[model samples]
Target: MYQLNLARSLAAGSVFGQNAVKCSQMLVSEGKLEPESFNIAIGVAAKMRGQANLRAFHEHYLEKTSEFRANKVVRRFQEAIDSLSIGSLGNILVEARTTRIRPTTRSTGLDEGVRL
Candidate 1:
């Protein structure tokens, strides 16, 4: 469960997301992780990195598992793929960047001009 959560977190990251998905797949293949964990991680990767980025992973998983199509996450992902036009599929990064809200820094109680 810990590893699964870690994989999900990594899958949500922009830089290491693809590698995390690949590693999750490898772990499943090696019996180090559950198949469901791989599904969850891949689903997150597909959502965060976009379906285009994870297409190879999707294809490989589909080829390897008869149950791939039946998984709810994979089913929704397939639905999303089918419903979206090609152009919209490329907007995941743009959407992510545009929608993010940055936190504001809080002022310390000390004097404003004093160096810490």
Candidate 2:
């Protein structure tokens, strides 16, 4: 079940990431979005590829600008990120928690005599 859920999450994120790029391209072609608007989609795609563990909403800085003056592009990206299901997020959390390492106890040699 865990493997199935993870596969689905990856597939969904892949489709969503592609859709974002396509949407940005369409906007650019239609003159509704500036050429720079495509940068956000590119950034998202790069991050998604590099960090499979990251959720769409967890992607930071979709664009290079310190301040985003374009609301439409931002809105589109937000909508795309928001579409991810809660189950995917839960699965990611479960995977992360399971991989965390527990603290280890100090080992003492038998010849040295252990202190309690």
Candidate 3:
């Protein structure tokens, strides 16, 4: 169930390119998904979106290896990191936030002496 949701979030983020980081962060840190999934999801997000800093990601993952090493379930985590670490991530296009402006409304009250 958790894996399914993680994949769903990754897929949605990859395709839509919105909430990718938030979804990835939630899934990776709290969803309890596989460590490899974390790497893969973050990698895809970085490629699809911007990873901010690949160097930081690599360092953080490497630091976690020893902690997860005892558990054999996360062996593939290294592979995911390796795949994401290859070459430059290339340029990233960030979508700009749009602001909506409300139309101004004027009301002429009984106090017409004041400007509307």
Please give the TM-score that candidate 3 achieves against the real structure.
Answer: 0.21
Provide TM-scores for the models.
0.26, 0.23, 0.21
How far residue 31's Cα lies from its native spot in candidate 3, in Å, is: 8.2
TM-score leader: 1
**lDDT per residue, candidate 2, 1-116, as tens digits?**
34434544555757555644554555556775553455554544443543443333233433533334344445566566556543353334334554578786666766755645
The alpha-carbon deviation from the true structure for residue 53 of candidate 3, after best TM-score superposition, in angstroms, is 14
Candidate that beats the other on TM-score, 1 or 2, i.e. the better one: 1
Write model 3 residue lDDT over 1-104, tens digit each, in one string. Answer: 46556656666735434444454556667765664554544445555433344444555666777544433323454444446442222111232356799886
Residue 9 of candidate 2: its Cα lDDT?
A: 53
lDDT tens digits by residue: candidate 1, 41-103: 444445555556456556666677765553545667667666754334434422446457878
Q: Residue 115 in model 1: shift from native, Å?
A: 28
Worst 10 residues of 3 by lDDT: 86-95
**Predicted structure 2: clash tally:** 0
lDDT value, residue 100 of candidate 3:
97
Residue 49, candidate 2: C-alpha displacement in angstroms: 1.2
Better of 1 and 2 by lDDT: 1
